[model samples]
Target: MTICQNVYFKLKKYVPDDPPEMGGLFGGRNGVITSVAFDQGVSRSMCSYTPDVNRMNAVIEKWNLKGMEFLGIFHTHFLGVRTLSEADKKYIKQILNAMPEYIVQLYFPIMVLPERDLIPYVAISQKPDVLIQKEELIIL
Candidate 1:
């Protein structure tokens, strides 16, 4: 998996101090991430972030037009906590359930830290036993 440097920088710039959690969608092709859609926050606080559905849908439509595929979702977390929360797990399950059969069955739940390092979670439908696990991130 490859992350475009521009996309990474944009995600960092989207964070607002008050909410402390900012999120968006990433678009890519052939497993290489190319673009990011910084979402309009509907409900967000220090501990949580929620992307407006209309905004998410709009981003999907816009990126689809550009020939990019949905690469999964990304959000920021308070520094020092790299593990997926219960809310994260629930959200991941929901995302997995709603995923289309034709689309990729894997979802990469990424946690962006204040230090600018990415901590990624691995989740694949085929391996239910290990639904989410932390893994090193590689950005290019």
Candidate 2:
């Protein structure tokens, strides 16, 4: 998957250190990520984040106005943690289930602190053919 260079820097700026995992929704055209909708901090902890739904929905509407598609969601993982946790996986499924039938897939990137690299994945939302797998992250 491709991402804008600015998106990388923006995510970094949100989480300079560790502990409180920062995250938000990302948007773009086609399949390339070009914009981000940083969620308002509703409830964030060292290992979890609850997106501000009102803020997120508002951002989505704005992106729609700008002719961009909601691409995916991203969240940070503490240092030494390089993969999505069980809770994270569960949430991904929940998100997928919530999506409209036409929105087939969503990208999910885990930002690892200190290391500062995004490990990306794609989750397919088609029933009876559901899947979740790693995606090559291309930041440019």
**Candidate maximizing TM-score:** 2
- Taking the candidates one at a time, how many backbone clashes does each contain? 0, 0
Writing each residue's lDDT as its tens digit, candidate 2 over 1-140 gives: 79999988888776647467768899999889998877634665556765666777688789989998888888777765778787778878877777677788999888887887888989898684557899998888
Scored by CA lDDT, what does every candidate get?
0.67, 0.79
Residue 98 displacement in candidate 2 (angstroms): 1.0
lDDT of 1 by residue, 33-115 (tens): 78877764566456776656677767878888988787777777776566677877777666666666665444455554656
lDDT of 2 at 94: 78
Candidate 2 Cα misplacement greater than 4 A, ranges: 128-130
